[model samples]
Target: MKKWLKYSLISLVILLLIGTSWFTYTFFIKEYETADENVDNIVDTDFEVELPDTLEGDLLDKNESTDKNVNQSKNESTKNQNSQGNNKETSTRNKEQRDTENDNSKSTNSKTQTKDNNKETKNQTSNKNELTKENDNDDQTVNNSPDESTNSEEESEKTQQDHVTAEDIKNRYRPTFQALQDQALAKLNNLVAYAYSEYKKKKENGEKVSYGYFYKKYKSAAKELEAKTDATFERLYTSLQQDLVENGYSKDEASDVKAYYNQKKDERESRMLSKVLDKF
Candidate 1:
């Protein structure tokens, strides 16, 4: 080969090498710069959203506030329920107390009424017992015949049927010891009345009869009765009061004697229960 030809070939090769290097540099430079710009844009816009952090924080605060308001409303409702329950309990207790007081008052009244009824029944029973004892005290006839001793049971039965309570202490009277005592007392009391009546009569007739003069005559008559009787007038009068009904004195005769000694008192109370009774 010629020397010049070899040199030319070498130059051509060198030129080819330079051209290829230029094309690759032009294309690759543009691609590298575009990648760099894309990297910058990703860095600027990465991890960013449409909604701001400030706005998200406001939404979270609003949600928390709403939850707090609901909780407060629930607490207020619970408090109202508790208050209503307490009020109902208080009302029930008050009603029960009133009922208890009423029951106690009714019980007290009932006990008082029961006691009164028992006392009345006891008084009636005592009066009946007294009458029975008086009837069993003696055997007597409705006649003043003390010397005639009759042993006939039939006659005694007939006499008991017509015994005592006879009017006017004359000869025909109950031949009991009580009746005889009452008869003697009646005679003395009648004599005392007659003595006073005679004094009044003398005073009305303008006689010189003072209280001393009347009392002297009354004592003289009392002395005569004392000498004729086995017992003194004072002793007999005391015995008559203590042993009137118990010594076979009739109720009518005893009542007459009592009328002379005492005044009638009030009537007895009733034993009926109360009209209004508790139903509960």
Candidate 2:
């Protein structure tokens, strides 16, 4: 039994030695592989550290560009603000200049208007003074003419007597007839002057004064005169006839006065026409 036990112990001892050897070999191989893996990781980490410098350079360039852009934007904004300020100042100055010019023009226009008004007022006053002076001279002339004054007094006395006899006729027949007569005389004088001027023109032109030409001109002038004189005579005779009738005159007496006045007017017109024709 002892011999068997000794053999068994030897076998166990040898087997245990062999197992320890195998375990130690496996641990050494695993440690070597782990150390290699750690070396490779350290090399990779060193390479990544080298790339960080290039990345830092790119980041610095970008930062510099961004700062430059920010400074340029600020400079441009300041320039724009200054330009706007200058434009505003110029516009203000122009507005002030326009206002000043407008004010000056208004002042000049006001002065011109004032001067024109003064001139017009002076002219109106001068015209009024001249009219007053002319009226005074006419009154003085009327008062100084002895024959005219005597005739006027006689006419006034006759008018007063007629008023007593026919108040209605006196009231209706005013001195407007004298104005009418004066106007008619002025027209007659103008007609005579015009005829004389025409005759002078005909002589100057060396035109022949044939009987046919003279008759034609005379007839034309007579027709025009008749048209004007007939209207005047009708108006005056109608008014006179109306007055006479209203003054209690008989219709026959009113008709007689109208007829006589018409006859006298016709005779006067005929004589005037004859004189005008003879002159032509």
Candidate 3:
């Protein structure tokens, strides 16, 4: 090979090498600068989003207002709950006070009724004592009379006549006395029948009938029957006494007849009361 040709070939190869290096450096440097600019833009946009000062102030004010509204709503709810609790406490207190007042009123009423009953009973006792005193005074006046000796003689004679004529008086007046007794027994039967019916009605209605209550009712009825019969006997005795005096019987004998019939009435009343109350 020629020296000149070799040298020319080497120079051409060196020129080609220099052109490739320059092209590579220019292309790589431009691409790297573009990538760095893109990274900087992403960092600014994604990591630190900044607003204008006026917009930021408006957002801060809106957040503070929302927090204040929430606090106000919570406070209002708490106040309402406290008010309801206070109202319930007041209502309970009022109810308790009313109950206490009612109880006190009932106690006072019961006491008043007791006082009235006691006063009435005292008055009745005083009246009965006065009546008994008057009766005793009248008996004393009769005993101290001027004709006392004559009355004693007459009473002794009448007693002797009463002993002799007792059976005759009974035979003459027994039918009338028996009729009166029958009427009294009929009245007692009516009362007993009514009371028994009431007792049966109470039992059928599922009411509890206490023995004491029924006994008291029957006892009261018996007392009423006795009182009414005693009054009737007194009236009948007065009429019979007049008839006996007209028929030549002594006053003492007529009085003995009255006494005997009165004893029979008492026995009948006691027996009827015991039987009726026992059935109840």
Best by lDDT: 3
Model 3, which residues run further than 4 Å from truth?
A: 1-172
| Segments of candidate 1 deviating more than 4 angstroms | 1-8, 17-51, 55-59, 93-97, 100-104, 107-280
Candidate 2: where are CA atoms >4 Å away? 1-164, 167-182, 208-211, 240-249, 277-280
Per-residue lDDT over 148-241 for candidate 2, one digit per residue giving the tens place of the 0 to 100 score: 4345545554554454343344333334444444445445555566556656877899985444443344344445554655565556556655
**Backbone clashes in model 1:** 0
lDDT for model 2: 0.53
lDDT of each: 0.44, 0.53, 0.59
Residue 23 miss distance in model 2 (angstroms): 99
When summed lDDT is taken over every stretch of 10 residues in candidate 2, the lowest stretch is: 45-54
* Residue 152 shift from truth in candidate 3, angstroms: 39
Give lDDT tens digits, candidate 1, residues 1-101. 59999999999999999988866554433222122232223222222112112223443565565556555655655565566556556655765675576
- Model 1, C-alpha of 95: deviation from truth (Å): 3.4
Local lDDT at 25 for model 2? 56
Instruction: lDDT for model 3, please.
Output: 0.59
Comparing 2 and 3 by lDDT, which wins? 3
- Cα TM-score per model: 0.23, 0.32, 0.36
Worst 10 residues of 3 by lDDT: 43-52
Q: Which candidate is the best by TM-score?
A: 3
